[model samples]
Target: MISIEIPRPSRRIRHIHIEFGTLTLDYQAGAEQAQNVADQLAQGFPELMVTIDDDVRADLPPLPCAALWD
Candidate 1:
């Protein structure tokens, strides 16, 4: 049988968004604090250069986000 796989983003919740142009991380926190999750990812993965966007970009073409989950 052939196996198919779906790629998912590494996020604690569905509200978080990550774009692969330069590892942009975004999260929908409370009204006062909007970038709580994005800050966490940046600190946790210091080896990689990542950016945080306040809003999601809906105009990008669909493509492979990651080669490996880990």
Candidate 2:
């Protein structure tokens, strides 16, 4: 029951796609809002390991992604 945030760049690179596990939030809302959502998830799902992606670009090695989900 762990949650994750994946910041994916849009096709035009105009926005940062914010995804929480299978859920997606408003990309234009910025990190604070995203973090708030993450906090909420953490509080709601107390039994799950919670994590939020730190805006790591997709081009990086898979390590960061792995760390997030794992």
Candidate 3:
């Protein structure tokens, strides 16, 4: 089983928002803030796998929608 490690809050983190369905994690932080958080997490759990994916609304790809009934 692949265990997901979630590090506790530190002085660097400002906000953490989580959503249920997709298990979306939203961190209100920039590159520096994120780096600090990752560094903290790495100290205790060195084996943990951490992935960061930054999303910009403007760069999002358009999805195909269903055609309207005639």
lDDT by residue for model 3 over 2-59, one digit each (tens)?
A: 9999997653223323344556455544445555555655676665544444542443
Please give the RMSD of candidate 1 to the true structure: 10.5
TM-score of 1: 0.28
Instruction: Give TM per candidate.
Output: 0.28, 0.32, 0.36
Query: What is each predicted model's overall lDDT from 0 to 1?
Result: 0.43, 0.44, 0.44
Q: Lowest-lDDT window of 10 residues in candidate 1?
A: 61-70
* Per-residue alpha-carbon lDDT of candidate 2 for residues 1-70, written as tens digits (9 for 90 to 100): 9999999865221123435567643332234444554566577876444444445554533222322322
> Stretches of candidate 3 above 4 Å error?
1-24, 56-70
Pairs of colliding residues, candidate 1:
none
Cα miss at 39, model 2 (Å)? 1.3
Q: What local lDDT score does residue 34 receive in model 1, on the 0 to 100 scale? A: 28
- Candidates ranked, most accurate by TM-score first: 3, 2, 1
lDDT of 1 at 37: 42
User: Per-prediction count of colliding residue pairs?
Assistant: 0, 0, 0
Model 2 accuracy (lDDT, Cα): 0.44
Candidate 1 ranges with C-alpha deviation above 4 Å? 1-34, 54-56, 60-70
For model 2 the local lDDT of residue 40 reads: 61
